[model samples]
Target: MPLWSLWWAWMAGALLLAILEVVAPAQIFLGFAAGAAGTGLLLLFGLPGLAGSLPATILVFAVLSLIAWLITRRIAGVREGQVKLFNHDVNDN
Candidate 1:
């Protein structure tokens, strides 16, 4: 198959995996989907050669996922603290 077609396939597969991840609520496939999405983005940018691109994309996705997780954790922590303050009054009733 052609390179463009293969790229589209990868993107479609990534979208499907993301949807499945949502349905199953497992974080595993999300990484793979993120990697595929990164690859698709690279292809969209007209990056030459597929040899190094896939691995690079995977690495990028891994790093990004880590950062996102950390940020989410921080946000959740703050939200939890806020909830406690607001909920204390409700608990008295």
Candidate 2:
């Protein structure tokens, strides 16, 4: 019961973030949700040394969150066409 609690926390955090992402479309919360969910899956596998160190766990979370954020930005920032520019002033004859 106690050991599984940590994974539960991660899973809960992921779900919360996913909900937030839907409520607010900032495109970042989804990334966070992905990171948290991935971390939770990792922790579930009983990785050595990851579950023992608080600092390492926090660092991993931060790194994963950052990576997720970057990937989200890259995917969401795509542009297909160039903006039109004009040198003439409007209403000028």
Candidate 3:
């Protein structure tokens, strides 16, 4: 397949995976979605080289996702002292 077509396919897959992530909210597929979107953008811009770009794209996506997650956690007040799993407080007072 041509480069453009391949990029489109990746974008489509990414969109689908993102939608699934939304439904599931497991925070797994978003990284892949970001990677695919980045790759699609790069392909659309007609970059100088295509070889080894997939790995680079994936790395970029992973880094970006990690940063985003950290920022979100901070904004959401997720501190190390708080229990994140199965810890719901009930108002009994």
**Candidate with maximal lDDT:** 2
The per-model lDDT (C-alpha) reads 0.63, 0.80, 0.64
Q: Looking at model 3, which ten-residue stretch has the lowest summed lDDT?
A: 43-52
Measured with C-alpha atoms, the lDDT of residue 21 in candidate 1 is 79
lDDT of 3 at 12: 86
Residues 45-88 of candidate 1: C-alpha lDDT, one tens digit per residue: 76666535556545655775566455545654355346534546
lDDT of 1: 0.63
Q: In angstroms, how far off is 59's CA in candidate 1?
A: 8.3
**In model 3, what are the clashing residue pairs, if there are any?**
none
Better candidate by TM-score, 1 or 3: 3
TM-score against native, each model: 0.50, 0.75, 0.57
Instruction: Please list the residue runs of candidate 1 whose C-alpha ends up more than 4 Å from where it truly belongs after superposition.
Output: 2-5, 51-93
Best-to-worst lDDT order: 2, 3, 1
Model 2's C-alpha root-mean-square deviation from the true structure amounts to 4.6
lDDT of 2: 0.80
Please, what's the RMSD in Å of model 1? 6.1
Once model 3 is optimally superposed onto the true structure by TM-score, how far is the C-alpha of residue 80 displaced, in angstroms?
Answer: 1.8
Candidate 3 at 11: error in angstroms?
1.3
Full candidate order by TM-score, most accurate first: 2, 3, 1
